[model samples]
Target: MDVVALIGRILFVVLFLGSGFAHLTQTEAMSGYAASKGVPAAKLATQITGVMMIIGAVMILLGVWSDLGALLLVVFLIPTAVLMHAFWKETDAQAKQMEMIQFQKDLALGGAALLLFALYAKLGDDLGLTITGPLFK
Candidate 1:
């Protein structure tokens, strides 16, 4: 069960871990896209969120303060979904569908993060294979 939990943790974090790296490494390109979406201070915001993603992902991956990590991810996801994936703003049908998909994806991932936050808060120590218990409790 512990191993299974660990594996689940690893799998859950892979997207964030990889995307975090891309956020940092491809800041210029990502920022350009962000600016296109009307994100102010796009470059700085991109860099900051990149760091946030990496840090949050690491915390969850290592089971150290995972609740806070989940919160961080939730924070990142909400604005991202609203500001970046505003499907209603799209004029093209295909683009609208794509944005809507991304928006839904973010919402689903954010919900999962919230669930993990609550889980870690309730089962901090018993979660197994953890470096430290959840930060909240």
Candidate 2:
């Protein structure tokens, strides 16, 4: 692995893992935040999002089932950007600005996930994993 890709993966790991921790540790607060966006039982939303983020982050970091991993992140972040960080229209100028930035970040995260999907087939390709009879090798 070249230094740059390795660094990119590390950054990906840090982001997803850190977000998972936030969801896990601050469930109640996040749940309240969710409720503010019209989410029902925001507390439950926190737990679900936390668990999902952890699973996805672990898979990506381990380079196992990474295509699925990216898919999970992509799916999770859409609702997150739309519901949790909603910035569509807000009269409170300051609050709107913050929410807009948050939304943009989530959108960027989602885009990265899609990029992962596009790049999935080449992942660890240099490692040469193949299925064959022992004699075939």
Candidate 3:
């Protein structure tokens, strides 16, 4: 494996894992905020997102079918932006502002997931494998 690709995978691991930890650590806040966003079954959505983040993080870190992880995250984030942060119910100025912020965050996460998908092959090349690790093959 070349040095640069190794670095990229390391970066992927760090980024995903950190975000995952953030999700796992902030469930109550997340759930409350999601409730404000008018999400149905807010608690379940929060829990699901938290778990997905942790799982995605670990998958990226372990190099275990990280492409799939990336894809799944993209799928999750896109609907999240639309459903949880959509402007329909955000009549108040502050709520609208918060919705915009959340939408942007979700969009950014989706973009990051797409980038991971597009770059996974290069990453694998650098890591000397087609998947995250030996068992992932």
Q: How many clashing pairs per prediction, in order?
A: 0, 0, 1
- How far off is residue 3 in model 1, in Å? 1.0
Task: Looking at model 2, report the run of 10 residues with the lowest lDDT sum.
Answer: 128-137
lDDT of 2 by residue, 1-137 (tens): 44555456557868878878898898888777778789887888788878888887776666666666777889888888988777667889898999999999999999998787567645433322212111111
**RMSD (Å) per prediction:** 0.7, 5.2, 3.8
* C-alpha lDDT score of every prediction, in listed order: 0.93, 0.73, 0.70
> Compared with the true structure, what per-residue lDDT tens digits does model 1 show for residues 4-26?
88898898889999899999999
Ten-residue stretch with the least lDDT total in model 1: 128-137
Ranking by lDDT: 1, 2, 3
List candidate 2 stretches off by more than 4 Å.
122-137
**CA lDDT, candidate 3, residue 101:** 93
**Which candidate achieves the best TM-score against the true structure?**
1
Better of 1 and 3 by lDDT: 1
Candidate 2 displacement at residue 73 in angstroms: 0.8
Candidate 2: Cα lDDT at 114: 76
What local lDDT does model 2 show for residue 42?
80
